[model samples]
Target: MTTKTEKVEASTKIRPRIGRWEVDDHNEVALLGTRCAACGEVAFPEHQICVNCGSESTEVVRIKGPATLRNYTIVHQLPPGYERPWVVGYGEFDGQLSVLAPIVAASRDELHEGLSLSLCVGVTKVDDDGEEMYSYQFTPTKA
Candidate 1:
């Protein structure tokens, strides 16, 4: 947990994280989530308190993919951590879940809603000190 120098405790065992929620892209391989017992609403980044019903009681879960694309954007501009000219946007799945992720669409013409995709773990980039930064990306089922 130190800056300027990077060390990954265990690369093979490490998973994605949003705040304290650990996202394991294995069994339930999409985005890890939580559902509210009170309202049956879903949340990403796994919230303990449901925003929909304000319920403290919740079930931590993961969304398996075979997801249908909701909507997409071809990014001619890339963010600080992204490669230039990458496509990125929301990938909507069943159960009302949507993930804001990079879409590995073959071409801009091929991007659209309802395209089938799956979750993949990959090295996004190498940082200043040569640490391999990893993340989840949704790619077309065949690609």
Candidate 2:
């Protein structure tokens, strides 16, 4: 018997992003946003010009904890880009920021608008080569 090993590179799938997301060992996920110090408006992915007040002073911030499922839909058809056959949606957090993401509930019955939810980091799927594509999703919270 012989054992073989293979080294895999991740450049074939979705491009990796930086500085716009946060993940942990527990699989919680959320969009990283920035806040404008001069105008006090929150911006996703660190905006230099404040959209609301036109200010240039901003700082990085993370939107975590306590999000509500605002709306969702099951996507059967994938665009020329992106994944398919997934329930994708957006949620409004307790921090008054609305973030759109994939719905990772066990079933459709588990999703509803205004449902309390939690963020988690997750692997989208495994490729034919057994490579894992990681992404984020929101799950409904318990009563």
Write down the lDDT of every candidate, Cα atoms only: 0.66, 0.66
Tens digit of per-residue lDDT, candidate 2, span 1-143:
11011112325544544225665556555567888898788866457788779888877787785688888889888644345678877788766567776777547777777788777656665656666655656777756
After superposition, the stretches of candidate 2 with alpha carbons farther than 4 Å from their true spots are 1-19, 24-30, 79-84, 125-131
Clashing residue pairs, candidate 2?
Answer: 27-120, 27-121, 28-120, 29-120
TM per prediction: 0.73, 0.71
lDDT of 1 by residue, 1-143 (tens): 12111234444545445312233534234556888999998887688999788999999876667777887777676546666677766777785777777776457766777788776655565565566776667788775
Alpha-carbon RMSD to native, per candidate: 6.0, 7.2
- Candidate 1 lDDT score at position 83: 69
Task: List clashing residue pairs in candidate 1.
Answer: none
**Alpha-carbon RMSD, candidate 1:** 6.0
